[model samples]
Target: MVSVPTHLVSADTEWSPLRSVIVGHAADSCFPTAPPHMIKATMPEEHFASFRPKNRFPASLLDRADAEVRQFVQILRDHGVLVYRPKAIDWFAEGGYTAAMPRDGLITVGNTVIEACFAWECRHREIELGFSEILADLEKDPVVRVVRAPKVERPDALYEGIRGFGQKDAVNGEVNGTHTVHSHEWAINNARPAFDAADFLRFGKTIVGQLSNVTNQKGVDYLRSAVPEGYSVELLDVTDEHAMHIDATILPLRQRLLIYNPERVSKRALQKLDLFKDWELHAYPYQPAPRENPPRYMTSGWLLMNVFSLDEKKVVVEAGDVEFAEYIRKLGMEPIPCPFQHVNSIGGSFHCTTVDLVRQGT
Candidate 1:
């Protein structure tokens, strides 16, 4: 039996004994709408045409995704973890993205839940529409603090001043004004604080993050100021030009062992942070094959690295990734397989679908 956690929002590290979490619903999920440059920068090239307004995901995919999520919830509950569900919202009606990827909007660090300042306008209301109630409930504990995203008066300012803010060919390889260049120039300008919560990961008192198509320098600064005292946000120099979220780039299986995608981030980048000095970091050696059936609309095949840890010894992985399961097993982790390809069809896998609320030993 699992013991109840004293606080509702208390998690710092990714690999801990998860006591409570929020598993998202997949109903009414739609293809998230964004400006041409933004969409071109982050989404799959073949699926760009489907990202217009009011484009709902195929009904068949949503149904299967919901089933997978429900089964995932059951598996978590069977392990004695408390699960929270968000109120379903019609993404097509709200002109927003699906709530199935809550890790993109909310990050629980220490005892605080900080909402992301979303760069895409379609995702601005995601937390308010689907997760307000859960935040309210979490706030019932005196120790839990919910740091809401500040309203953006001029959302378009984020993309303004760029050479091609709305053009299809704007983000094609040239460095735009003032935008930091990594593998490629970032899509969004540093006009306002903008970040998806998935861009940052908590490691005890230090949060490691990156600037991507959706995350800017200002966003990193805002996160640094919003985190609790003694907590600091550090940026890693990742090499993925198509980067949006950082979950697939790195995976921390437990306290000392971490698995990373060598294709996106280099070993030197990981070494830049003192936090990993004593930790073991291994680059994923195998390249994951692309799924043709479900069709990854938003992410790459590297989503295989997006596994979630239930504790230091056990992790939740996609059922079909037997090769990955076996690989991690050799590293001393038991992979609990669950079917999530349909969930992958929309966006993200286990780590992207849920937010760890109460992990013991934080």
Candidate 2:
């Protein structure tokens, strides 16, 4: 059902410096894409009254899924892991993403956090990009801080995802995930998009279930149900074209490693295509067709690879050969590949598989 690398058997995960990670609901519909079947589970009689996740998830696979992820987060924390929570951008609803306490791994340029809009999801609460300040407070170190684009504009119809025409459709039509670019396009530091969902899911975002009307608001509800109370939600406002997909250009990785469709971003984004700051990036080339069973990039996101592990030089990526290898190399970092053979078609990779709760150290 999935393709894994032959050499991964000997690959060591021990040396990994996994720190913060991003988690998502397993077997659930991808963000912005609703799983229609989930609607059949029956909402709690009181859900309409209180609209509470606990009531909705009184006991079900969805509840179980949330527990597994939370437990996973707790287990890692117990092991001295400094988990930094990534806000779940409920693209399908109003509160776009739920903000996690800021820690390491967040990025900023010009005194403005690249994740500023992420805080916009909540009405009363606000989540700012505190990663850079946090990192600065400790080491007083400075990495590249430059605002390349102001905001990403949705891709022209020419580049939006076109059916059947192959990448030519994707390219001329937003060539990669650029289809989701917004009215503006900008990147502080023009950091590589690899660490973002778009890069990881260049091939396609694996959407399970159906569009069950589980909108961003519901997504926010789901987060409040799981994370500790001190937290709030922040969701990105998105429209058609890009829909609710996570924009990869802004993901903040403590490590500079990146994954993305070089063609989908702006020339500024493209300018940094080969630049991997101290990080050994991995590139997973995507195949435009099912006709090409052995797609170039199999480790697409929205699946098992949606996590951010704070490991050492030995980062575990659930990708095959080709772009995966190139991706790590692009980051100026080394790769500790996973067994995923054809992850792209299925949609995901190591990052997609695990989620991040960032901290200074793990």
The model with the greatest lDDT is: 1
lDDT of 2 by residue, 228-322 (tens): 23332333322222222343222223334444333333334323433333443333355422224433221223232233344544444433353
Off by over 4 Å in 1: 166-184
Q: What is residue 18's positional error in candidate 2, in angstroms?
A: 5.6
Query: Mind sharing the TM-score for model 2?
Result: 0.34
lDDT scores of the candidates, listed in order: 0.89, 0.29
In angstroms, the error of model 1 at 181 is: 7.7
Candidate 2: count the clashes: 117
| lDDT for 174 (candidate 1) | 30
